[model samples]
Target: MKTINNSSKALLATMLTVLAMAFSTTTQADGHAKPGDFTRGANVWRDNCGRCHNIRDARELRDDQWYSTAFHMRMRGGLTGQETRDVIAFLTSSNKPARKPIITDAKAPTASSKASKLSGKAVYNQTCIACHGADGKGTLPGAPDFSSAKGPLSQTDDILVKHVTDGFQSPGSPMAMPAKGGNTALTDADIRAVVKYLRSFSK
Candidate 1:
């Protein structure tokens, strides 16, 4: 009984040590997030992080702590690249002291600029690749295959865009695509870019 107890305690200590090391490594690896990804991160937090716990207020952690915690959670949650950056952005941005925005009267971009600025492939990779797949052949069981002639891409651009923006449950499919592909930060142009990317597979 004494030997058994010692073994159990040793195992527990080893596990704890490994965990601490992992956390430390993750914190260091995450570093600081760049700006502009905060809105995307907010959406990621709501969609993914909310699954396990009440969405903690981002202000709950200081900047350094947020980086560590977000990085740790990212490893556990399987977030990568921009998704991780975005979450960190959301947390760190929220940690800032709140203040009213300085308003400036500026005209919106012209149509040509908006069209050129967004990349369909980048948007698709960031938002849709999780479910829809890197090959346009969905990871989810019922995710529509963009490469298929009779798939979602077969629909008119208007119909596809509407379905994507508003979210869609295929007629007989088990999984439902989330609204704005779960990234509410995505602009209308972003959605169109994703659609264009998907359509590329058909060509």
Candidate 2:
């Protein structure tokens, strides 16, 4: 019984030592930026960083991680040394806890009982064909062809709706697909109809 007690005590001591080392490493990795520095960083980020990348919500990365990421982006985006440091200061200072995005079911408006309903194809031609093309083959560089068998429409309806509404950026591409083709007037139902139309052409 005495030997067993001694083994348990030694094990507890070793665990405490490991925990202390972990805490020390974490503190060194995530040193805090100076206060009031984030505002300057924000301006720098908007001028230099906003052109290529979306301003990520602060909760995405820890203060330390953000510094490292900003340094890398500075090199890639050709930002000046001062500009990079200012942006890092802003990201770290403005860092806050991330809130969960609210996900709600978007309901489509009901068609009038006596009115004729428009077909998805009709909607596509009238509204979408200009950008997406008649064959659902997008001609623009940033646009993806729905009929090409390599586009996002081949995925599920939910994914298509999200992309169409929220938009996306291809890695290394300078341009991004704007939300609802950059038309804020598009309703959730309109986006859903477009998704349906696009999916029909998937090979």
* RMSD list, candidates in order: 8.3, 18.6
Give, for candidate 1, the lowest lDDT window spanning 10 residues: 97-106
Best model per TM-score: 1
lDDT for each residue of candidate 1 in 24-106, tens digit (9 for 90 to 100): 75334333434437557756775787577655655467878977787788788888756777887666655554222254224
lDDT of 2 by residue, 1-203 (tens): 43558889899999999898777753332233333243355556545654676545444578789878987987788865566676776566445422223543344333311232555676566445644667877644455667865666557889877776666665444455544543444556776777777777874
Clashing pairs in 2: 38-90
- The global Cα lDDT (0 to 1) of model 1 is 0.69
TM-score of every prediction relative to native: 0.53, 0.39
Clashing pairs in 1: none
Return the TM-score for candidate 1, rounded to 2 decimals: 0.53
Q: Kindly give the stretch of ten consecutive residues in candidate 2 with the minimal lDDT sum.
A: 107-116
